[model samples]
Target: MAGLLQRVKSKMAIFAHRKARGMLDGEYGSVFKGRSLDFDDLRGYVPGDEVRDIDWKATARHGSPLIRRYAAVRRQTVLLVTDTGRNMAAEARSGEAKKDIAVLALGVLGYLAHRHGDLVGLVCGDSTATRSLPAKGGEAHLERLLGHVDSHTSLDAAASRIQEQLEYTARTIKGRHLLFVVADEIAADDAMAQLLRRLRAQHEILWLTVRDADLAPYPLTGQVPSAEVDYCSVADSALLPWQPAASAAVKAAYTRATAERDAARRAMLRAAGITEGEVAGSGDVITGLFALLERHRRAG
Candidate 1:
């Protein structure tokens, strides 16, 4: 079988050709707060090189503007945090497996960190148990991390409780890290909000929510296109598309409830100083991640 990171790189390469090359890398690099001043080498300055980084002596000696490159004092550690449970195996809003979307999000961010010369780690689990992989560098380590998430999540796994993973991270991980979290539409409660605030104080946090499938029928259109399909929830509940809950009145209620829920989640994360992004399927992973990283950079 082909490697997952190759798939991620292919998507990035395609996006680069479509848009501007290295645009995603530039965005990812801008979010980190510090850079080392220990000089590594000097190179000819580019058009967008920082004016303050120009070395006059080097420029005069080389007969052109030169920029000093620094050896990174320390490699930043990015902790890929996610839930590997039945909920993650459920259908996403785009009718794709939610776990696949989670894999793409994690792989893209891990690859970005790898490209930035940082170590990447993984912390993922369901309600029953949590697992952590030590921070390590190299594409092999990243592939293992992605594989862990991909292989462990399934409909037969334990119920989703992302909070357990977060709590484990807070308890065991002593060092500060950039936490990239991907999960389903988890409700925001006081305890979860408090946990996020605590984590935010200790580390940089970015969230990507994999939207759950919309169970109700299309609103006010009398459309039952999927009425014949049998839908089953991760919790073993059968969801008939033609159920009473699919009525127009019920759809309206669901819409309002969903809006309120989404608003509450955004408010909670904003209060905790975390930037949140949404991806509906594999297709939206790259664009959603770009927006997420850009928002985090702007927030900083």
Candidate 2:
């Protein structure tokens, strides 16, 4: 079967290409607009009316003053860091795997960032950090970012590496923007915590993690190819031939490893004060963006 990245890349292109309309959430993307005035009800005031919105003629007739209220301005820059490590490909968590979910999540986030008029960029890597796209705005630029995320691959899965990447990201970004780190697992606790403390101090940071169901205890679809395989999940890389006789045991071990990684991720995020969104194999892009937007509002 084709990998999850390939599948989601084909699917999300359609959603991102569509022209956004009405509210941002309407297009299944996050919307960022400037300090546009929000209409609030008019109310009579005894003081602080600066002689504005006070129907002078009506006030003259009623002998009173009134004013209107508006919501605060909206201003933010966004930087997205995507971790495409081997941990994502582990068969432990969900049957669908983590890499697939992470890719789709990035596509959705890119769409929303474009809607809000915020510059969008991506940092994709594995054992060693790879591509770096500077945050920029425009339909074409976002398309390039989407294309970039489509090609990423990683070698490692430690969350501690996040701090190193974040520092580099901070140096390159040059501005306080909302930071989104999309990864499947968060096992490197101490590293993640330090990164979060510093990142949140300078910018609003959010972690978007896609979780699979299989790791939480589920039946396995037993099938082991009786042939040499490209094994990508081993800590110290080694290739081995698959044997159908032990497929069941292999599946069990896979399940346990994935479960441990998932638990580690949840615990690490909780300790770091980072929130998580579960991205399923068939998660909704629009729904997730709306929830994220609501969270941003609450924070504001």
Candidate 3:
């Protein structure tokens, strides 16, 4: 775990020192454009004005529609919510552990927050237990928060009740905040969707899903000798031999199913007004995060 922290810190150091005119810097400006509670002024309502932002009282008095504008707050609150369940412990195709990828992802965001002098906090747990750290500033506090996450995360933990974590966050956190949720490739169910809707109403949300190795595309080879593979879950564990060959049709079907699932997940997140990024456990987490942030920057 110490080595993992050191590696993450090293990577983040590079990111932190990058030139202000770099792609990441530009994107960060556009993506996080002026999110603040400080009111700037009132203006004539535009066609795309958010209904919630409209000053109805002012409009009635002036007999004209008006909208309130706010300057982006310099110091923002950043919260990292992670699911440390058994599924997150699985190995990726690159042979790197999913938990490690998750930690790297968290580190990237936490370091960014620290650099900006923003308050950083965390909400992480599995089905067995959940933990939270209140938002605080300073590099030392951020290090302690990351260390706690590293110590508590376990692959042998029970299935994650992600909804419970969300509930806890919604209940405890007040005011507007930037929320980053890191978890496995689990689709949003109805209950989860409802919870996300509520949270999105109050906070800016970014979802990062760690891709599962089993879902990666593989070339089909002719039938070969069977090999033993270990399969374990919260309920049981076993090592069983299985055929290596998969027919082209089976491969195509699997690919289609994976695509459809991904599409559905994307749609669900969009509906909740949340941007999402998928990071393969075996891939460079920093690169993936940069891509995600770039996409959001472009969209914004």
Candidate 4:
């Protein structure tokens, strides 16, 4: 028993160190406080059920003892929509990839939401969309979300699935929910808007641009250097096998084009009343997320 207790202690210490549990008991209003006890349902009053467990509503009707049951308070519903496209799977760290970053962020969010009595769900998209179980309160739900997230593969199959998922999301969910998207840079500035309108009609939306810095900045590496950078790949992928000078020019031109795309992306986000999240080189993913939630709460 002592050894078991020590193991438990060690596990808790490790979990606490991860900042997930730290934030749980942290000074913030994150720990979901209990709500006023209310009716849940009624069953037979057990020995420990306070006399108050008696449900007058059923008791009076049935002329028998019906213990009142009160379930835990309902928490917020926070949904994470992860892009499982090839873009999102790019490796940033030698060992950890962009998909790893996304999943880690989702884990953190799920843990925090669990503490706040919030229901957490995850939707991963490629060309198709894959979703975990619907949001419900509990650590089990978090585990389930992670399990589903881990099961996802970023191959081309997701393409068709994502479209179908988007179509399905519009039909099933009917009320406001907090929806977050973790995706690579978008091609269309208005892409997010269309997604929001179709897939997340009733939810408040936020988009987290998960990227590897290399995608934006091509570094001079190796004696031969990176394959001739073709600026037109994003615009037109047909131009290839250019001369070294052409590659240099392509790289320069891409620098400018990417900047323009970013500007357009942000402008579109603002127009749609959505918040943007950034996570870059050796970057701390939680920095912007904390601020996003705080600001959102204040707005609410």
Clashes of each: 0, 9, 0, 10
Distance (Å) between predicted and true CA of 136, model 1?
0.5
- Report the alpha-carbon TM-score of model 4 versus the true structure: 0.63
Candidate 3 structure quality by residue, lDDT tens digits, 116-227: 6678899988877789989898777777777776666666677766676888898988888889998876675887788899999888888888876653223433434334
In order of TM-score, best first, we have 1, 3, 4, 2
- Cand. 3 Cα-lDDT: 0.73
Q: How displaced is residue 281 in candidate 4, in Å? A: 5.4
**lDDT measured at residue 91 in model 3 versus the true structure, 0 to 100:** 65
- Pick the lDDT winner: 1
Q: Which tens-of-lDDT digit does each residue in 1-300 have in candidate 2?
A: 654434544555554556322333443232234322343565677665535345566556666675554455453556778765565555424456565566667755665567666667777666566558887877677667655654554344532234546667756666466678876545656766676676666666677766544422323445544344443333556553344325567767977887787788777665655656655564454455556556654444
* lDDT at residue 176 of model 1 (Cα atoms): 71
lDDT score, candidate 2, position 280: 55
| Local accuracy of candidate 4 as per-residue lDDT tens digits, 241-263 | 43432366767786688788788
lDDT of each: 0.86, 0.57, 0.73, 0.56
* Winner by TM-score: 1
Worst 10 contiguous positions by lDDT, candidate 1: 30-39
Looking at model 3, residue 55 earns an lDDT score of 86
What residue pairs are clashing in model 1?
A: none
TM-scores for every predicted model = 0.84, 0.61, 0.80, 0.63
Better model by TM-score: candidate 1 vs candidate 2: 1
Instruction: Please report how far candidate 4 places residue 94 from its true position, in Å.
Output: 8.3
For residue 22, model 3's alpha carbon misses the true position, in angstroms, by 4.3
Per-candidate RMSD vs. true structure?
7.7, 9.4, 4.4, 11.6
